[model samples]
Target chain A: MRLGRRFVIAVPTLWLLLFFMVPFLVVLKISLAEPRIAIPPYSPLWEWVNGSLKFNINLENYSYMWEDSLYLNAYLSSIKIAAIATLLTLLAGYPMAYYIARSPEPRRSILLLLVVLPFWTSFLLRVYAWIGILKTNGILNAVLLWAGIIDEPLVIMQTDVAVYIGIVYTYLPFLILPLYANLVKLDDTLLEASRDLGASRMSSFFRITLPLSMPGIIAGSMLVFIPVLGEYVIPALLGGPDTLMIGKVLWNEYFSNRDWPVASAVAIVMLVIMMIPIMILRRAQARGAEI
Target chain B: MSEHILAAETKPWVKGTDRPFVRIKGITKMFGDLAAVKDVSLDIYRGELFCLLGGSGCGKSTLLRMLAGFETPTGGAIEIDGQDMTGVPANMRPTNMMFQSYALFPHMSVEKNVAYGLRREGVPKGEAMQRTADMLGLVKLDGFARRKPHQLSGGQQQRVALARALVKQPKLLLLDEPLGALDKKLREETQFELIRIQEELGVTFIVVTHDQEEAMTLSTRIGVMDAGRIVQVGEPREIYETPNSRFVADFIGSVNIFDGEVDVAAPDLMRVNTSEGPVMCEPVAGLTARQKLHIAVRPERIRLSRTPLEAANTMQGVVTEVAYMGNLSVYRVQLPNGQCLKVTAANGLHEDNPITWDETVHIGWSAAACRVLVK
Candidate 1:
């Protein structure tokens, strides 16, 4: 029975190594592969001529990254945009989470369901809906003009601001759910104790509630951030050509220019940058788990 | 102005003489249609450890919450130190509550938890630290100040919670099953420790517990609650020895209770016609004649002997089972009238060893041994 149990566990372990671990090794090998712009539009694995083996290796792709200013700019812009989007999501979602968590049982379940219902619909459909709402002749500007609040339709869509809005709206549920889960499990007596100790409502929020919700906040921010770093679809749909995100640049390299090695380098650099916060968040979650 | 005051005039502080330290008057709490606490009035004097004893859903915790300002009374008021606290929030109330779960902040260390309330009050860092140290010492947890709540054992965590609640020094301290988390031996030890601390600080404590032994051991006075109302309130001895109602008699301890009619009533004693036969009971004052009453006799008060005794009252019974505890033996005896009587024999050096199972025995008790109860 024990050997059968061991086999049950080892099967999934072996499958993961083959599918996940082996593909990463392939990617690593391709990352070091030589890039030659030729007829087939691909690098040859080896050059075998006159029955002799020749190991041709170069660091040209990595050195090329150092000289490319656009790659650097794309990397910097992605970081800045992801940070702002995360901040906006946190500001908007924390209070909504608190309200949901503190609501009466019947209302709490209904509100949570409503928040999560958006996710069940197609992700592409939600972004497409945003486009109609945020365009120059969109619902927002049209309503404002009808109300006589605006003289003309304002240019609201296809801007960095539009990109930010798309990111925030897309990931708001991811941020709020974890925050609500953590806040609901919080000891309400601690708040009462703080008040009895002499803190006003506002002070208690900053001192107790905010600090204690750090782990959830970090988890939520990372969840929104990691995907937004590599996000190409929303930015492509909402941002102008000047947006200069790494995802857009990487897409241009792969499909438009057919430069796989540079695209792979961009992918690798983005993954590395994203891993920093993810590692920190995993550490935080581990600490919370210890508790 | 003081010189011009009349001789009949009293100072503002001296004006209130008879008000209780904490008074709850006509307070009612309703959850939808079910009344959790209904029009309950109580006066808890300063330095008194009052216990609200009841079974689950008895509304004891609700009353304690009202005193702590956590729950607003649907009607009437709660006052502490003669101040009206009807609309006051729990944080603003001059009271603190020790929750049944202890509810210690898991993220904070013992010192931090104890100092949290004082720091909220804008006390300086140095002063908060000093006071925190003092509180930790009061709970005998001075060395464990740096440890988190989960690091401490259950008993230590309980002490930490107690210190945290008492550090604020509120006018009243409400405890909801304060010792419920501890083991039996630790609970008993903490019960006496709680009394000693309360007496030393001279602070009023209103404890809510479903444990009868906890209430009896720690309370100067106990209020026994059933449903949402207080059924009776008296000292533990008074509640046990001379319970006014059958409910009180049955709730406080194990008793041999019988439904009976009051056949005769006198100043000192009364005769009751019980199913087991005619039994005489000691009369409690204010009982009238022909009252439908119940009679209670404690198991330990009855005596058993092998030889049949020539007495005014005796029951011929057979011992069905005998449980020999280390200190005492419990005998379940069946009488000729088809009633089971529980008799306890104290174990001392060869001290009154009880009869074995299936042995024929005669049981008797004095008239004063049983109490006449009116439900």
Candidate 2:
């Protein structure tokens, strides 16, 4: 039985090592090498010289990233944008998820289906559709003018606000799904017990419901924040030039500028920065399971 | 009002000077097409441990929820300490409920769970802490105050739930199968502890349970429920010995009911002409001749013997089955008329292998042991 259990776990561990760790090691090696104006676009970290191994390591790509404010600002802005979008998604998704969970059984499945309905369309196409709605003469502005709520068209496209709206809209289901799972499993008796113990409706919500659903909140936030941190399509289609993000910078560095080593260095730094929240999420999940 | 006072004086637990702590008048709760609790009126005295006993889906829990203010009655009113609670929410009502699952907050420590009610009431931290400590001590869980609910055993978690509900010292405490999660042994032990704690605190308790033994042992009074209506309300012994209907008699314990028509109705005795035999029972007022009725005799009340005894209420039967329980033996006797009667006898030390299967026996009971039910 123990051997079979070990074999079961070993298969997935071996697969992760080959598919994920090996590629990550390759990226790390490239990040330590210097960029070259050649076909491969980067120097090898080790070379054969006079029958002995010679090292050709370069710290210049990493140094250059620190020296340039553009890369630093891109990293900071990506973090900031992802954090704000995660907060917005949480604020919008909590009530939606709570209502869906509390809905009658027949209606609950339909509400959950509505939450995941956006996934039927391509994510890129959805972001593009937002462009038509958020543009100066778009559907939103046209509707406001037609309804006499505004006299002129509102300029919403190609801005940070538009980028935020796009990220929140696209990642909303990611946040709500986990939250709904947690909220639906909550015992209704707990709420009634809280009320029986003299807690008002709002107080009972804070004292019992909020604390119990913290795991879901953390899981949902990580789902949105991790992907939005490296979000490329939404910002590329809806953000203006001022919306500097690390994913966009990495794309420009590797595809447009052809600096593979620098781009690899940027990727390495992003992974290190994201490790904090990923570790926090694992710890929270473990604690939730323990409870 | 004077009549109410006079009636209250008759009850052992209720003094004539003290008013009913909870007065429910014709309260009915309907769910779409189903009436969960049909128009039920009951009066529970202060310091009385009243139990609502019924089978599953019998609306005992629904009545308890209505008393706790979780469910609004479709009609009538509930008065607690002379205050009308028709529209009052659960939080504002002077009642606390210990759930069947013992809904202790998993995230909170034992002390914190106990202090939650006082905190919601905006009590000062010092007093709340003191009271929480006192309540934990009362439940004998003071040593485990820092532990979370999951860290405790089922019985310990039950104590935490009890402490949390009682720390607020509400006018009434509602327990919905509070010992349902515990094992049989722990449940019996907790039943006594619950009664002790209830008496110590002097808080009116309304416990809902499906276990007849628990209700009999823990409650000062038991309200037996069937379908959606209360069938009888009295002390546990009265409910057990003198059930008003066949439903109550069959639900409370093992019984052999004889469906019959009233053959003779005298001022002193009544005779019921059952298919098996004519049953003589103690006279019940208002029972006329030819009226359809049932004669219910508890299993333990019937006497069994190998030889026929000349008795007023006796029948000859062959023992079909004998189940030897630890303290008692249950004998299923088959009569010549094809009717099966259940007889339970205590296993005395000298009566080993007493009356084996297929043995002819005489089954008898006193007239007072038989309860006549018209419903």
Clashing residue pairs found in predicted model 1: none
DockQ of each: 0.59, 0.89
Q: List candidate 2 stretches off by more than 4 Å.
A: A1-18, B1-18, B266-268
Clash counts for all predictions:
0, 0
What is candidate 1's lDDT per residue for B153-179, written digit by digit as tens? Answer: 999989988998898887888898999
Candidate 2, CAPRI quality class derived from DockQ: high
Tens digit per residue, CA lDDT, model 2, A17-42: 99999999999999999889998999
Docking quality tier of candidate 1? medium
TM, chain A, every candidate: 0.92, 0.96
Give candidate 1's error at residue A221 in angstroms: 1.3
Worst 10 residues of 1 chain A by lDDT: A26-35
Stretches of candidate 1 exceeding 4 Å from the true structure: A1-23, B1-18, B266-268, B284-290, B308-313, B351-353
Worst 10 residues of 1 chain B by lDDT: B7-16
